[model samples]
Target: MLSVSWCATAQVFSPGGGTGVWRVFLDPIRPGGPFSVTAEQRIANAVDRIILKDVYFGDVWLCGGQSNMEMTVLQVINASKELTLASHYPYIRLFQAGLNKSLRELNDLAGIAVQWSVPTAEILGKGNFTSFSAVCWLFGRYLYDKLQYPIGLVESCWGGTPIEAWSSQKALSKCNLSFNVTNGDQKHEATGPQEPSVLWNAMIHPLKRMAIKGTIWYQGEANTAWHNAEYNCTFPAMIEDWRKAFHQGSEGSTEIDFPFGFVQLSTYHHRVPDDSFPWIRWHQTADFGYAPNPKMRRTFMAVAMDLGDEKSPYGVIHPRYKQEVAYRLYLGALAIAYGEAGIVFQGPFPKYFQLKNSTELRITYSQELAVLELSKDIFEIRCCTMWNYSSCKWVSAPIVDNFFNILSLSLEQCQQKVSGVRYAWKEWPCNLKKCPLYSKSSKLPAPTFIIPKNDHL
Candidate 1:
């Protein structure tokens, strides 16, 4: 028999026959704590006791995704300063799950790369792609700065893995993908961590029993290469399935519709021109081109189109400026998770577009817009004459007027009626903080978007 107590309440449980494993359920407690937990058991004539000290009851956020989420504090910009400042937040606990994969769901974690511990300079600035995650750490640190309470962050991520690897088979089915596995088949050879449901089985499944506040993800780069088309379905399916799994695992303690936050795919290659990256960004929001939409409710997004890092030592694909990324995510968490009001979590987005005439088109934004005056070719229009329908081409549309929340563009360059319009639709749209459009108050960059011929205004 084992008995556990917390907040002056006691629960008794019996260990199972062979595993000697028992579970104790506790009533919900308020979020701030540096408290302790003790488990006691009695044998024939002796007593065994285990005490866990400095335990916390605050929000526990699971940070998951690819290399961007795996990048450590040391690999980010101003690493030394960030590491030193990490010591100031003793209440922020960090845990990193070791890299592992399984063909079946796991009952417990395979390994813990970094156990729950308070942040330290050395610990924060550990290996390049191991242990502490800069975005996870900074997001928790920012939350602690505001909430002034304990914040637990768990990093369970693998680099270069697609969303399928982290999603369950049920989730994949939503996208019409079949992920099959044979039980007790040790001969199965996994191509890598990218195998579907492997990371979910070995890393995410085990942690489901633990209650979590929400999740912040930085992925979609891997999916950009392949399965990019299914992302709009797969991504939202994964979120829905994870929420269901966690809620059931926690015995309904975790919210069924917990908040989710994700960083839209950032720039990949400055010189390479492709629509894959921009398409993934749009798909990440279920093709809504923004978050918290009908398909993905209670969610938020951080746009990284303008935060391109062309000279990063690690690689241009891995932006070193994770602080800004984390800060933007933190703002979303404030509004979505913490219920903070008057929070400008998202940048200005196009509310609607109107074809003023044959030579002009006007776009109105959700908020007041500001032009950084960085690029002249951010907007493009597809035009094709009746005789040249098969030879349609996209031409640059110059901004004729940008005032308040409305932007007027000249369509005179297109000799024929414009059929499509797109903005910032490139792997690298602009230099860091130099995107042409942004929210005047929040300074957050507008997300990339495209309006097809049928939907063009």
Candidate 2:
């Protein structure tokens, strides 16, 4: 085990652990409450080896993912209100971790002491909010106010990084993921996050068994180079490994299936985008439906299909509308993590499709909702070639039944094969104002997906 030897000069805490503050690594194994350092040893007297004590017994969340997750609170378009408001929450803590590469798993975070400080307002001074993760800070602020508990955020994220970097070697091997970025070109070192297990060893492994409630991920923009089909297996494997890591070490958790939530990819226009980007969104949704373990349903997806910034001719992959993303994550956390009653967490999902006739098909969703304008949001037939696709013209699905929540589509009108039918399957489907479909109960838009197999009538 890798341990750090350091001294402390932070504020002292009261004996009873009242409304106050302390900055030190408290004994994580004690049950009754957070306790002070159990033991300490001097190292040659040159180094003051003291295991400091901190007593913030709140839930910690591992905010892990890539670029989008790295977006700061200052970047939000109308973020002044949030930035100022965030400074008031002293209970909310931030433990910022930087990027590092490792050939083997690491037992501690790289660099200086991993202190839990408020990311906003530096202890009575205005030294926070300059580096807080926008989505994460908002989520934590909301949750802290609601639950009234100390919320610690461990940000283990890197820009343009792929999911494999945060995953364990054992997990990747189990899923047959053998991509080694080290063997590839060395000149592209600054490209970020394609390498596997590097960030996990340096940033994540150090936090193992350091009690966290769950993780909130906002990534997948960088993984377009990897096979999209493989994401269905790789993503879950990563989540499972993280849960295992969180349960290892001295402060391990018994709950294997820790509640995990993620922001589904948003709409964006890139000069040269990956073909598998859209499919990755489908796989994210598919995990909720087809995970090998039923408990994986605890995994929730915050659909950003309606939040893509499409006005820009070139398109904005990183949309400034982080408030909606945070809200959706709030809804997900409220329902999935907190198990709130009478709350709507999920949007409309394809329950199943039934064949009504040879040309027409009936589509039903898991939730019931009023069918709105579909002329722009949805496409009926599959477009094979660009020339044929442009002229093919998408035929919108008409509202069939409000009670059953069905949208009727005609296969004959599309003049394409019946092998595939999907909605908002494009890389930038959210680039439009009118979303494909929405639920009456939740009002959330329909997620992007290609119907598995040929459900042709």
Whole-model lDDT values for every prediction: 0.87, 0.65
Off by over 4 Å in 1: 1-6, 15-20, 183-190, 386-391
* Native-to-model Cα distance after best TM-score fit, residue 381 in candidate 1, in Å: 1.2
Best-fitting candidate, scored by TM-score: 1
lDDT minimum window of 10 residues, candidate 2: 121-130
Native RMSD of candidate 1 (Å): 2.4
Q: List the pairs of residues colliding in candidate 2.
A: 120-128, 120-129, 121-128, 122-127
Cα lDDT tens digits for candidate 1, 146-175: 998889999999989999899998898788
> Each model's TM-score?
0.95, 0.78
Model 1 C-alpha lDDT versus the unseen true structure: 0.87
Which pairs clash (backbone N, Cα, C closer than 3 Å) in model 1?
A: none
- Model 2 off-target regions past 4 Å? 1-54, 112-114, 121-130, 179-192, 270-275, 286-295, 310-315, 382-404, 414-417, 431-433, 455-457
Candidate 2 residue lDDT tens string, 84-147:
7766887787877766777667776665323577555332123222255778877887788788
